[model samples]
Target chain A: MKTRIPVAVAFLSGFLMIVAFFGSGEWLSMLTNEALRYMTIVAGFSLLLGVVSITQVSWGVVRKRGEDWPYKIILLIALAAMTGFGVLQGITGGTVFEWLFDKIQKPMMATMFSVLAFYIASAAYRAFRARTVEASILLVTAIIVMIGRVPMGQYIYEDLPSVANWIMMFPNVAVQRGIIIGAALGAASMSLRIILGIERTYMGRG
Target chain B: MANQGNKGFFTRLQNVDRRVLFVLIFASVIVPLFFPLKLPVPVTPETREFFEAVEAIPDSSIVMLPFDFWPSTLAETEPMAVVGLRHLFRKNCYVVGLSNVGMGGPSIADRLLDSIGGEFGKTYGIDYVNLGYKANYQAVMLGMGERIEDIFPTDHRGTPLSEIPLMRRVPNYDSVSFIFVVSDNVAVDYWVGLVNSRFGVPMGAGVTAVMAPKSLSFVQANQLVGLMGGMKGCAEYENLLGYPARATRGMDSQSIIHLLIVLFIVMGNVGYFAAKRKAKVEG
Candidate 1:
């Protein structure tokens, strides 16, 4: 009864959304619009779910004195402090929140992102060996794209940028379109299966 | 010590400490910044198209600039956002700034608009307004097509959208002449699908370098009227704007890093081949 009722609701909602998209009925528009608003509100609450999950995980780590437990404690503290300040004074809460974000979060994000350069360089050096004919082709293509994408490539060879643009415009676009189309078809099929009650994975039985 | 003959130079090269590689990459990126290469930034057609598209917007036409990236991508996309905002403000276009990514985005937009708007002698709530962050990108986007105020009742600072002077003139996609989403992720696709295709609003993208290749099809199909790809794209736009900024300064470092990575790959392959030959000889 539980599964059946949820499936029926999903089907009805999905069917109405389709109608709202295709049909011109004013009620259909209102129904879909309200549904969208509901979905947004639901999504907003899901963020709270994320916060709760993080808190639970962090608390468990600290309570157990797990590896790097101090970091976990710090994480919980920062999270609570940020949320408290944000709720009390809002994002524009001036000095404290702004200072925390700019001084701590912003720099941390930047540092993490910056470390990618070193890692990418290391990974490339270790992995980009031309072991096979296919790998050789890939290596050459990658080098060409790298050169072509930057200004130095133009300095080195006037036609390099054009060649790079051609590669991106033709071969890259062809592949990207294929992936997009495949994903869209897959998503459509999955949506159809869900609406028809053939896909009950979301109900935790699959 | 006896097996040292088998440990050829190539094998040794293959075992180079990773720390050394890191240092090389770091130096390659950092040193070039101090010593500017001043290489010519050959503008791509896509970037040129982006600039021309923004330039062609008739004066006082509204533009929707959606900030859709966090600080993780601030390095790549922020410059584009800065230059894009500058271009719009320079054109005297009425701009509406919003963020769908969360608090980070709206704050970034607020700062960008405040810094850039002042130079253009633009006033908040009049020439430009920041609608701030809203949840559910699709819902917000679709709702905006129907009525923007329905989705964003207030600006980031809690000011009523109705009270904003610019909001009176621009209510939805119909009023906006151009929409550019500066994103680190697939939010550009949402803008393309929801806003542009459905509402017929012309759209552009300022995306991270990693995302540039994926967006080529949209540009080719004219679904995205223009694309500014990463920091390079920003440098091109800055050149067009005649205000060389961070993106321009960083290009030298970017160029050197690319070359360093390429050189690393080539060197690794050389070592690989040498190791293979050494193994055959030993056998």
Candidate 2:
């Protein structure tokens, strides 16, 4: 009965949305918009679920004195402090919340992101070998694009940037469009299956 | 076995410690900054298209702008957003900012607006309004096509849209001249698919370098009118705007880093081929 009720609800809602797209009826459109709003609200509420999960995990780690309990405690403290500041002073209230975000949050995020450049450089060196025909072609194209996209590329040769643009505009676009079309078809099929109740995996049972 | 000694050098190079490479990359990015290369910046067609799109918008026309990126991508995507904002304000276009990505988005937008809007002496709720971060961008985009006020009853500042002079006049996509989405992800796709394709509102994107290649397809398919890809793209836009700024300044470091990566690839290949030749000789 539990599974049946959810399936029924899903089917009805999904079909209504599909109908709403094709149908011009005012109520159907209104119903679709309302459903979308509800979905948005539900999405907003899901952040609370995330907060709960994080709190549970962090609290458990602290309680157990796990491997990184110190860090867990810090995380909880930071989370609590930031949330308290945000709620108390509004996000744009610009004292504690802004300071935490700018001084602590942003710098940490930037530091983590900056690490990617070093790793990508190292990875490119280790992995970009041209032992085979396909690999050699890829390596050469990559080198060209890398150079052509930068200021130094124009210094190397006048036509380097033009060649790079040609590659990106033609071959790259073709491949990407193919992938997009394939994914769209797959998504459409999946959506149809879900609407028809043929796909029950999302219901937590096959 | 005569060539064994030469093979050791190549093998060692192939197995060089990554820390050494990291140092080299770190130096490559930093050393170039102290000594600026001052290389001539070339404008790409994509960036030119983006500039022209902004330039083509008639004065007083409202542009729908979405800040759809995280702080992590601020380095690459934020510059484009800032420059784009500056150009829009300079052109006397009414700006409406919103975000569906997260709450941080609206704050980021506010910071940029406050910084740039002050320079132009633009007043809030009159010349521009930030609807703030909504929950579902797709729903917001689609709903706004029908009626924007129904979706966002108030601006980010809690002022009613009706009270806002700009919002009262520009209610929906009918009044919005362009939809500009700046994101690290495919949030531009939502703008393109839901708003552009469905409602026929023209759109463009400023995306991070990692996501730039994928966006080329949208530009090619005429789905997006223009695109700004990463720091280089931003630099190009700055060049076109005749207001060279951070994006231009950062290109020297970016150029050096690209050259270093190419150097690493070349060195790795040289070592690889040397080791292969030695193995072939032994066999």
Candidate 3:
């Protein structure tokens, strides 16, 4: 009953919203808004669940004597700091609480992305070998573009830029559009299953 | 093994070493940027078709623009958003912007909206209103179709939606001419499913290059009104909007990266086939 209840609600709510689009009823909007709030509450609870699960794992790591366990402690500490700061901010709308979000959170995300620069470069070195005709063309094109973007490619060859330009404008655009359209159709099918209550994986098991 | 039998040039070319292809692609991409390859990019009927949708809508027609990409995708999306927004503003359209990605999305949108909207004397709530990131994309989409304000109870500025003149008159998606989904993730799919399929709203999206091929399928099915894909899409958009901005620059960067990938692929394949030929002859 508990599992079926959520599924039923998802199905009915999906139908109501679909109906709302065609009709001039004011009631559907209110019902949809209520559903949005309900979903938000459920999403919020996931944060608590995540925190509790992390704490339990860290406690286990502390209990067990293992090398590199200090990292687990660090993870738990950071998690606690973020959770505490967030809760305090919510309780008392103050500037200091906002500071953690601005200073710590924002920088962490930027730094994480910057770290990818090294990873991508490493991936390029290992994977960018010219082992075939296609690889050679790719390596050459990549070199041209890489060089062209910087001061080097034009310094070496005059026509590399124009050649690079044609590839991106025509071939790349055609390929990308094809892929996105295919993926969207798949998404439509999946969402339809959810609406029809055929996809019940999202519903919690008894 | 190299794919044998009756194969066309393009199909045979597809089997080349990925790296070699990457290099060619890279050179093909980067050279244009440093050298400023001002090659003419023909604005396709699709882009013009999409531009018209937003352009034809009368000025002050409320539009919902969702930014569903982050900084990584900023390389692809920001330009599309900027170009589309500029065109909208040129038409004197009022935008109701929101983000479904995360806090970062709204943050980027906030800065961009401020800069772009400022150019047009666009006042918040008066010209545009930004609602910060909201979870439950499906529910938000549902709420938007019925009543946009109810779903976004508070504007980014913490003002109630009822107080906002735009929200009061135009309560839902039915009022908006179109929805622009600038996405690097699966967020666009959610929009298509919830809004386009359910409500028949005209939907357009900008996505990354890697995901562009999949997007074509949507275009084929007419599920999408139009699309701007990756750096190239940005480049075309730059040409469309007459900015020649980041997308143009990144197109160069992207072309270089693609060339590098292609070069490596070609090398791998050539080496493999050569080795195979040698073994067969030796035996």
Candidate 4:
């Protein structure tokens, strides 16, 4: 019955969504919105399941006094602090929570992102070469683009801008076109699998 | 005859070290950047088309800006976002901001919008409302298409979207001049397939250069109105705004870095051929 209900919901919801596009009625729109609302509710349940699994793993590792036990304790402390503040703010609409969100959370997000700057250089420094034909082409193109992109580079050398422009407008466009075609083919295959019910993996294993 | 050896091309290919390649690629990117090179740009007909479309909208259009890119691509995307919102505000466009991803987005978006929109005397909630994070990506897109209030019952605060003066009478996409996506990993195709086709509204994308190549098809198919690519696109838009912003500054670093990479590539190829000739002579 549970399986039947889902399969039925899937078939009906999927069909109606397509209809909602064509039908343009308030009832159909509301139905579409309700499906989204219900999906969010289900996602909440899924999240709860995830939180439980994560807590259990952390607790288990801490019990064993694993090498990373201190980090696990830190995680628990942060988890409690965030959850407490989140619930409290939701209940009271307080600014203390907003303060914590702005001061602490935003900085943390920025710091994580800033780490990528270092990593991009480190990765690029190791990869760009001209040992092979393809590698040579990429190296040349990358150079042209890097030079072409910078104002100072153009100032130092007059022709750099023209070269950069050529690389991006011509070769860059060609490569981008290839990616678009490849991605289109992929999106089609995945959508087809879902429509045919062959991609039941999205629903999880029985 | 030297090429006839059993340990030929494939042998050399198999033993290449990625680290050395990294250094060459590094040099290839950086040298040109320091050298100062500015290429002539002929704005593509499609990008021009998008700019005209935005211009065609009424003086005080209600526009939806979706902050979909995370902090990962923030460096590349933020310029377009800041500039686009600036232009929107300049035109007296009512802003409705939403994030299809994380909770962190609204605060950053809200603060940036307030600072920029403040210049044009735009107020929060009335002129611009940050709808905050909506869970379930595809579903949210569909929900917002019909009734945004249903998807977001309240503004980021406890206030309802429908209760807001600007949102009170607006009916779906008709009221939304366009949905502008300043995104990195979220491709233009997703916008076209998920949002544009779903809602039948105009969509625009500001994408990173690496991702720009893949996005041309949406432009080709007329699914997207405007396609802004990377820091250069940001610089061009900055020029359009009559202001030099982060993208303009970043262009210095970007240009130099690209040159450094190219030089390294040439050096590596030169070194490789020289090494091959030396080995042949020794043999």
lDDT of 2 by residue, B236-256 (tens): 999999998888888998988
* lDDT tens digits, residue span B206-269, model 1: 9998999989889998999888888988898889879889999999998988998888788778
Ordering by lDDT:
1, 2, 4, 3
Give the winner by DockQ. 1
Q: Could you tell me the TM-score of candidate 2?
A: 0.95
Query: Which residue window of length 10 is worst by lDDT in model 1 chain B?
Result: B1-10
lDDT by residue for model 1 (A1-206), tens: 98999899889978876776567766776677777777667778988899999999989989999999999989999999899888877886365776688788977998999999899888998888888898888888899989998999987888999999999899999999999889889988999999999999999996
- The lDDT, on a scale of 0 to 1, for candidate 3 is 0.67
Q: Model 4 TM-score?
A: 0.82
- Of 1 and 4, the candidate ahead on lDDT is 1
Worst 10-residue stretch by lDDT in candidate 1 chain A? Answer: A90-99
Query: What is the fraction of true interface contacts found in candidate 4?
Result: 0.42
TM-score of chain B of each: 0.96, 0.95, 0.83, 0.83
Best model number under lDDT: 1
A78, model 1: CA deviation in Å?
A: 0.9
Candidate 3 lDDT score at position B148:
75
Candidate 1 local Cα displacement, residue A46, angstroms:
0.7
lDDT of 4 by residue, A1-206 (tens): 75556666677767776777678777776787798888766766777788788788998999999889989998887777777876776511345655666677656876786555445654554455566888767766776566655555556577766776666656666777787678879976876666556667667743
